[model samples]
Target: MEFMDHLHSHSGLLRLVPRRPFPVTIAPMQWYRLEFHMANELGTLLPSTFNLSDIHVECSLLDKSPAALSSHWHIDWQLLLQQGAWDSEPSLQIQFLIRPINTSLPPHLPAHLMVMVSPTYDGDNSFYMLPLITAPFCLTSKRQTANNLVPNNRAWSNYVTQHMYRGFSLPCFDQRYFLIRESWVHGTPGKLWDSALVISDALARQLLPLNLTRPLKVLDLSAGTGVIGLLLAFIGQHQNNTMLDITLTDVPEALSLIHDNRCLNKITYPRLSVAPLRWGIDKDIQAIQAKGPFDVIIASDVLYEPIKFQDLVKTLDKLTTPSTQTWIGYKRRGLKLEEEQSFFTLCHPRFQILDRSLDENVIHCFGWLGPHAPTLTTSLPPCLPHRVTGVQIFHLSKNSPQS
Candidate 1:
């Protein structure tokens, strides 16, 4: 497939001009430039009519208590206009003056900047928000600068390769960088799938309240590069109150990448570990069982395959204690809604699944503007002006046996 075709296939409406060096990194107190050019799936300019005055830049870290990171920095809109950053058409360009990482702002590590274009300035005009136009950059202290390495087989090498995700950062609770290896199946760490973000968002909002008085043992089952588990462990370490022992498990093929990612984060928590686990295999389950029951279980975007759904639930049943809570975040794969429905139907008998899709409380923590406006919900801000159609998070606990 051609380069542009590949990108259009993966990301329908979002296109990055000069899409290279993804997971854009920045040193503390340095200056960085951001470009905002948006187009729909057909490669046509979207929202073509907009004055510079109609553009607004909003910045925030994806955090439990997110605060604006763009307030005190300098922006040069005129320089951007002169250069014509967007194909000599109209594009928004803003130079960001990086600042010291503010601990007060709930530690949204990989900070994101949103370029919103309000179509009309007339009284009470409705506007469209483009979530694709984002600056997914991270700020590192001088000493930790070496952590950001450019991969040789770069995922976002060109417009074509960009469709195949190489690495991505989870912004909140410190930036967790993940390197992606191609998977034969759907779930991989490289793509910031909605399910992963949902799990991260849930943890950030309720980390303290959920584990306030007791230390909790956590598991990220079928973890792809350990994104969900690693985020929990790092966030717990940052909090210093809720003690968390995290175990990241997946098939043997995924173990090496998981180990590499754990190292990439420089985890010093002393309790995080990774091992191989295949669902429905006795030996694999035994390895997990050796660690005993976990307090909480997290799985993201792992239920798409219909054949493995039973084994997955069985594994969860074995690993979780009576009081343990399992959180599953799922995004619909293609048009197959029945597959999701079937997974839930089988799960209903053993688990009391609470539908927490698009929880307002979680949204509020991550800077949710009124529903229709372009709001930052987790890492990928919903730019569509509508809720993400099929993405949701469910809270699962053991259901009592019926007499």
Candidate 2:
């Protein structure tokens, strides 16, 4: 917990780090000071584990191109103990330094940094650290393919993907919801968030009570990797209770990914199905509606583009039934509070906001059917803001006579 406290104090470091000039060199002995603190109390007891808190580096710019600047840098850091006893040797516990051929290349700005400690039989746990970042730099020359711009370096791409996947493993739920995934197919973090597995977890947990007699019919809109639907299927299969019928729909490009994921998960349930469902497409909407009133509808991080938002809302209005509960979770990106408020206002007349929570820049909204559902505003309150995000629950009853 002490480490967690220290990290909380330095949460600003989690933001994207600006790209500096490249090709500048640094001495072996001199490196920017880096500090790390274990944020998980349990991590401290784990053998050969360390948590990253802050990273600092110094670099100089070498060449400026239309797309990016190139620079070299040096990094130094102190290792904080999260788990197991440190070796008696001073070197084992002392601050260490590493000087990788740091290149701050243009167009590739750092977004977020990740550090992981992997234990080995002979040597101590090795630290695999990577910074997740991107910059918008256009190429001056025309390119035929994405690979033409970047070299064929799978290592860097894999490293970035692994970093993102780890973020997905972090705890982002309460008792009401928990993410479930049988396995990651593409295993890319950036794509995972787009999958909205977290939202599906929350919806499944909320609807569990309603599925006492028969299997729950769940619909996942904009399904990317099909993580949400797969997780629900896994839960249903394991519990051996009610059957979980899942229908996943997305654009063609995303549908292919969903199909591969479904196959990768070895899903054989008669109720599990995947199909293409694009917003604003009449055929897609009708096909989705044919599935009938699903008990739960889950969508996550799908409200970025303005056009897509309107299309999505319109599609929801047509597909949702009085008995269906729709849940939407979005990470705050370019969308402003006013825009979000406007969105809610437009939907408020049709769907009720039953529950809401904002944590780690992510907003979760639970909506139910009916016109007279209760409108509740729950805040985090300053005291518990650090621990739990704002949690609000809303309810709409289709059976209500007033509706």
Candidate 3:
């Protein structure tokens, strides 16, 4: 039984890491491919016993086309069973398991085990036996390959529909910080933002406080997924135990999505509202100001184009009050590092940079400016940890004249 289990485990790992021929062609383009290797040994043996067996696996690109193409590859497993047969001929079983890492169930099969035998098997070779097995398993795929395996979108879609997206529900967060909404296009799945995570961390770190006695008004500019505002509302509920007024502002195309997300999340207060505001446009700024005197403003992943920096600054200048705290989170992208520095350089005099932190690919922060703050150098705090790639946090705050 132990040997059989070992064989099954070995085959399962091998199934996950199949090699491909180099320089596989996709249409006219050729791509390099790679494979992920699995570790040895099934469950640990009791003492010093050692078990060894030769395992061989092969994979080939099958089809890649609109209907079906030959660029995508399917993995085929062939293992030589050498162990002495007790009562039955050796067989191979493949298991398809779906497990999510973030405490959320993955969208497919919990566990599917299929037993197969060589065509030469004398008994029951005509039918395949599939048994459902429910257990936790790691989910990963090949990291790299020598052959460019054009993904089979059709098959992949079928696999996801049949296996991945059906059984799982949207993950729930304690603070109600995420805003998950479907795309405006029909049949598209919904999206979520982790605003609550950001805001809670910032507040705990003394970057900002929840001032409930005074009405907390939040402005989510370029609100891609309305994550920032959603987080603010979640935090406000905890600190003030009251509803937060949040304005979701974005371009015309995103407004409908924002509204849909707001409704889907069922955010009940400080009165969730949506407004169309294009960055750098006066009409848009005026329209956003109609809500007026925002206490906190948030933006996430909004700095991509360099041309939009000045307009963003202009919009910020119009929407923020002298004492307001504005938080902007952005993922670093092409030219983003230099462009962000340039943005801070221009806005440092008018706003005080309060705090900043980098996690994964995102930059999180809080900033404030006095009614008439002086020009300040863009120097981040020394305590911020340096990232593995040597990227340091860039934080600038309005300095008091004496300092």
lDDT of each: 0.53, 0.42, 0.40
* Residue 149 lDDT, candidate 2, scale 0-100: 31
Task: Kindly list the per-residue Cα lDDT of model 2 for residues 188-298, writing each as its tens digit.
Answer: 311555224335435545545434567667887776667777666645544455467788887866666666555543555567778888887889899888986788787
Query: Positional deviation of 72 in candidate 1, in angstroms?
Result: 14
When summed lDDT is taken over every stretch of 10 residues in candidate 1, the lowest stretch is: 115-124
User: Model 1 RMSD to the real structure?
Assistant: 9.5
| lDDT by residue (tens digit), candidate 1, 119-147 | 21222223333233233344545555556
Candidate 1 Cα outliers beyond 4 Å, as residue runs? 1-18, 21-187, 209-211, 362-364, 367-386, 400-403
| TM-score for each model | 0.58, 0.48, 0.45
Which ten-residue region of model 2 has the weakest summed lDDT?
366-375
The candidate that achieves the highest lDDT relative to the unseen native structure = 1
Query: Which candidate has the top score in TM-score?
Result: 1
lDDT of 1 at 187: 39
Candidate 1 overall lDDT versus native:
0.53
> Pairs clashing in candidate 1?
131-383
On lDDT, the stronger of 1 and 3 is: 1
How far off is residue 382 in model 3, in Å? 24
Candidate 1, residue 63: lDDT: 19
